[model samples]
Target: MHRIIFATGNEGKMKEIRMILKDLDCQVLSMKEAGIEADIVEDGTTFEENAIIKAKAIMELSGNIVLADDSGLEVDAMDKAPGVYSARFMGEDTSYDIKNNYILEQLKGLPEEKRSARFVSVIACAFPDGRIFTTRGVFEGFIGDKISGENGFGYDPIFWVPEFGCTSAELPPEVKNAVSHRGKALGSMKEKLKEML
Candidate 1:
């Protein structure tokens, strides 16, 4: 079987990716599991660009099907202030509690409609033979006033999905994976991956 390498050190992200691509008839290994430690700087201005950068960077070393993703929360009220900067909204080392609080503060007093936001994820798959494929996914919802649940990472705690009537973090793993931006992107890439493999 072919090997698929997810280029990330974040445990949450690694787990999510594995779950998204679990059915593939190949090995899904994180960078650490694949025995690679490369500092990939994310300086791109867009999600797709960042994902491509990481995927290409890792593909050089992994020599396997390297998968990378760049995702963030884009709030309409904030004019998408945290679109590409979601991960570093309150500095790289700040806690998600602070991040969630900051978002709540920004949307204070605003109605749910104005609090509309979306989570965007761009996933890139790069092969050792120079073939690269990318897919994008967006989760539409509003930001909640309070952080609820601890099921997901990043802005999940504050992202409220109207369809689900709850925060993304509150949804079960299977449910979240079916509606999450990462899930959408990974799902869209499933056929491509099958063909590639």
Candidate 2:
């Protein structure tokens, strides 16, 4: 099987990607497993740029195919704030709980209808020949009044799905994968991979 290195240390993301790509003819390996720990600076203004930066950095270091993703919650009420900086919204070292709490406090007392938000994911794949490919996916929803689940990382708990009557974090793996931004992006990438290989 072809081996592709994913440039992320987040185990949750790693697990999700593995599940999404399980049926493919390639094996996805995390940077840690690939013995790569280089920290690529994410100074780009957009998610796509940041994802490309990461993937390219890893490809250069390992000289292997690499995929990197940059995803975040964009709140309409906040004017799309915490977009690229979602992970470091509170601070570089802030815990998920603290970040979640901060977001909740910011949206406190806002009307439910005005609490619109969406999760955006951009995945970039870099090849050893300096070729790059990218795909984007978005999951539209509103922020809940309060945190509701404990299964997911980042802002999953506050991201409510009206049709499902639950937060993204409350959905089971299969359901979440069917509609999640990362899943959609990876699914599209898989099609591209099939064509390329």
Please write out the lDDT profile of model 2 over residues 2-73, one tens digit for every residue. 889999999999989999989889878999999998978899999999999999999999999999999999
lDDT of each: 0.90, 0.91
Stretches off by above 4 angstroms in model 2 are none
**What would the per-residue lDDT of candidate 1 be over residues 24-102, giving only the tens digit for each residue?**
8988888999999998889999999999999999999878889998999999999997998888888999998998898
Model 1 vs. true fold: TM? 0.97
Model 1 Cα RMSD, Å? 0.9
Highest TM-score: give the candidate number: 2
Question: What is candidate 1's CA lDDT for residue 116?
Answer: 89
lDDT of model 1 at residue 170?
91
Prediction RMSDs, each to the true structure: 0.9, 0.8
Residue 160's lDDT in candidate 2: 95
Candidate 2 has a TM-score of: 0.98
